[model samples]
Target: MTTIEVKCRFEAKLLRPAKPGNDKSWAFVVLPRDASEQLPRRGRTTVEGTLNGHPFQATLEPDGQLSHWLQVSRELLEAAGSVVGDIVTLELTPVKKEPEPDIPADFKEALAAAPEAHKVWNNTTTLARLDWIHWITSAKQLKTRAKRIDDACDMLASGKKKVCCFDPSGYYSKAFRAPEAENS
Candidate 1:
């Protein structure tokens, strides 16, 4: 197993800005671009670190605008007793591998029933498989999840490697989303 560790120490402001027409603000801590460039990979990376003396494990994601950031939920912020503009300390180390998302039971059955699709699915890369699972699980409604599973099997059997119209990196995906957009 190979391990790559990148540590960043900086003072960043915790900003809570609302998206246009959303009337809700999101809090996030932006990482400096230089620090971001030192990470092992872009996109979602499992990270363990400390924020204002509170330990946390989270996936660091790149917002389209910020390059990379940690979305500080209310619970996490409160745990650290952090407030906006406070200079919080961050020490992060990337995990060697990202764990796979759990496939829903119905989706597993759908794949099993389609041997051809299952074969193609078995041959897909781990990242590709993760994307398929993420797309299906991101559906907020049961009907949508069912439809995605069917669509996924069909696409896989047809030899498609990726979920159509889905952002596998999760920049715009519901599974992992950027806190805010510049065009907001």
Candidate 2:
């Protein structure tokens, strides 16, 4: 219900992006690379925009390939009277400020168990915390995720300010990527 200062406007075709376990994923639109360049950062950015006249506020995720993508919820699609495969108009702009990402419970617990890591986490900026969370959750497997959590705690305890060696834009290292579309 916030008034977004409209910036970049464009149209894109909706597609169903894949989820690891859930076959039925939300319709999503990948922002044009140029449009993404207009945003604040190549990392995770918060945006508010109208999709086919339906209002929405969401954290725009990096598309791994250097652009950005917004997951269109079914409710938003229905409200817009559109669906996957339809090209939709979008009046997009980055939010004035970034929101903190909610920490996963397990990660929160691990931080709590490590006083030094917890202290560092509390002292870090929201963006750094977000990157740490992203690096941990980007793991496609449960084992890798657990290992990342432990490593994160150790790194933080040792005074690391941010996640090192993580390619947030997925432009390099190829460790992160936007979910593949069903038809991709």
Summing lDDT over every window of 10 consecutive residues in candidate 1, give the lowest-scoring window.
17-26
Residue 19 C-alpha lDDT in model 1? 53
Highest lDDT: give the candidate number.
2
Clashing pairs in 1: none
Kindly give the stretch of ten consecutive residues in candidate 2 with the minimal lDDT sum: 17-26
The per-model lDDT (C-alpha) reads 0.73, 0.86
Instruction: Please provide, for model 1 over 94-144, each residue's C-alpha lDDT reduced to its tens digit, 9 standing for 90 to 100.
Output: 666666656779889999999999999989876677778867887879999
Clashing pairs in 2: none
Expressed as tens digits, the lDDT of each residue in 63-175 for candidate 2 is: 87789988888788889999889999998878876688899999999999999999999999998999999999889899999999999999999999899999887778777
Off by over 4 Å in 1: 1-3, 17-26, 104-113, 122-125, 134-151, 159-177, 181-184
TM-score of candidate 1 to 2 decimals: 0.65
Angstrom error of the Cα, residue 91, model 1: value is: 1.8
